[model samples]
Target: MSTRTYLPYIACAAALCVAQARADVKIGFSAPLSGPVAAVGQDQYDGFLLGLESVGGKLGGQVTTVLREDDQLKPELGNQITRKFIDRDKVDAMVGLGFSNVLMASLPRIAESGTVAIATNAGPSPLAGAGCLPNVFSTAWQNDGTAEAMGKYAQDTGFKRVYLMAPNYQAGKDYIAGFKRHYKGQVLDEVYTQVNQPDYAAEIAQLQAAGADAVFVFYPGGMGVNFVKQFSQAGLGKKLPLLSAFTVDGTTLPALRDAALGTISGAMWDVALTTPGNAEFVATFAKKFGRTPSHYAAVGYDAARLLDIAVRKVHGKTADKAAFAAAVKAAGTELKSVRGPFRFNTNNMPVQNYYAFQTVKDGEKFGVKLLGTPLSQHQDVYVAQCGAK
Candidate 1:
């Protein structure tokens, strides 16, 4: 046993360390890029890239490679993409796991592999509660948070009766539950429509017949456009107070235009936010992308900035999954988000401010104006079930 015999072993260990240090940060981004919600995915993707560009085209001083995929808002496609990112590409992190259904389908694989996933949009309640995974985080608010804000507003504003409507899905159900959690008023009807349903004439008729004081609906992307347009065309815009969450936003506002005017929606972020760094962000995004930045885009931008902090905290060593996850969690508090009062709850969902925004004419175009803050520093009701302390 010569002492010199250990030289090869030491050299081999050193080589391995150098190799790990030089490894690039690989992120896989999947979202519904080609379907009705394409704008939602596109805005998020663009914002993420903008964030990366702001950080000198790197995450934690490591060269980064992002593999983008289109899930087309389909759970099956999302599952396939998640598997490919995990089993084949071996990405260090995943972002934009698609809509709620798609995200739910991909969660098991993500948790099983212990891969870090930062969801820019989807925040299903199951993931926020007993199904909470340390590897997964949502930069976006919980699916219920904004709805809760609207519910609280409706309740506080003394609305006696309201009609509720949403797409039939996990998020839609959660949204309705969230609304009921705060609004103790008479719910005239709980209308659940097919996801991406084109026509809402029947629902509007039923709502009109119900004679509710106000109407609350949860529709995003193209659905929002169609719903608002129809609601306006039906002359309900002048007859009934239309309140919503995600039904009128930057992603849908272009098509919505004057049709969405006077619509009050609950949200966590918008161009109307005067939070520090938001003005520059909005300006930069609009200049770069040629449109107003949506809450989805804000979340995506925040995700990249959060990762920048986390990856740097770990000194470009994202290979240590535990360390990387911890860093990301810690980065939640360290980063100044474009969305105000943002931090990760124990369940890895956002504890942030939710506000009421009214769609209005900004000069000649439609944009949201901050009406008031309904829920401040709100954490989801399901966080207690996460058992994360």
Candidate 2:
């Protein structure tokens, strides 16, 4: 053991430490990439990549790597994937969980690991209320927010009675609850169906028999495609005024074609939204993907942008949990949102405008056109329950 030998060892140790400090930022993304909702998840993933591309494949001046996992729309599977992302991949942050159940199941693990997760689509009510966590933030609206806008619109349009339908799940319950909160009209019937129920023939029959003035529903992904096509075939789309949230969007509208035309829905963003950020996002997404981006895609893009802003503020050192959280909170309302005027509520859920949109023919194809704002600068009711300012 010569002093020169010890000096060499010390120099090597210092170099290794420096290398660790400058490691590339890793992000783990989990979503239903191979299930009924696969299309939506793919759109979300694509939008996120576009966001990263906008920043030149880096976040906060640090090279970033994204590891994508398919949750298969299963809560248990999602939890497993999240654990793997934390324990095996050693990701610094996480994004994308398209369904409420998957997001809810993955939360505890994410919280325990001190990983910040930005939800792209699903926003369960419980998380927005008593279960809110500082590490979890949603780039999309709470499940009930858009539904409430549709409900309000239905009330304003003088719908005396309405038929409501949704999948039998946490998001479905929240959607109906939000609608009831704002809709003063009588609900003719409330129907809960299976999550991926392909044929809505039975439900459509019931809807036609109910003799309701309007129909409200919350079906996303492939279920929306099936339901809308069936509804159109059953002649219910023409007979009863159809109103929905998350049911008819860029993801499903193109598939529905003429079937979704004239269908009214409530959403936070559409391709037709008039804003510089939205215009650029729409044009760029169409050019890149050769199709319209969905609301889920918009949120995914915003989530990446938010992460970029926050990581830059913290200099990409997410190991300092408190500083990273502060950076995220500070960046929440500052990121350039495609949806426009985006901010997080006390619960880390979005507080933004909800617009009434109509599925209309756009150059022989179907797309959603913003009709009017049903709710302006809206914050969720669950914010007060979260105990955050």
Candidate 2 per-residue lDDT, tens place, 269-346, comes to: 988899668889889999989998998889888888888899999887888866777788789878878887888888
Local distance difference test, per candidate?
A: 0.88, 0.84
**Ten-residue stretch with the least lDDT total in model 2:** 1-10
Model 1: residues with Cα > 4 Å off, grouped in runs: 1-23
CA shift at 239, candidate 2, in angstroms?
Answer: 1.2
Best by lDDT: 1
Task: Put down candidate 1 lDDT per residue, 1-389, tens digits, no spaces.
Answer: 00000011134533211222233788889888887889999999988887876776678877777779999999999999999999988989999999999999999899899889999988999999999999999998789999999999999999999999999999999899889899999998999999999999998888889989999999999999999999999999988999998889989988988888899999999989999999999999999888889999998999999999999999988888888999999999998998888889999999999999998885896777888999999999989999873
Root-mean-square deviation per candidate: 8.1, 7.5
lDDT of 1 at 230: 98
User: Residue 193's C-alpha lDDT in candidate 2?
Assistant: 99
lDDT of 2 at 116: 80
Candidate 2 is scored at a TM of 0.93
Which numbered prediction scores highest in TM-score against the true structure? 1
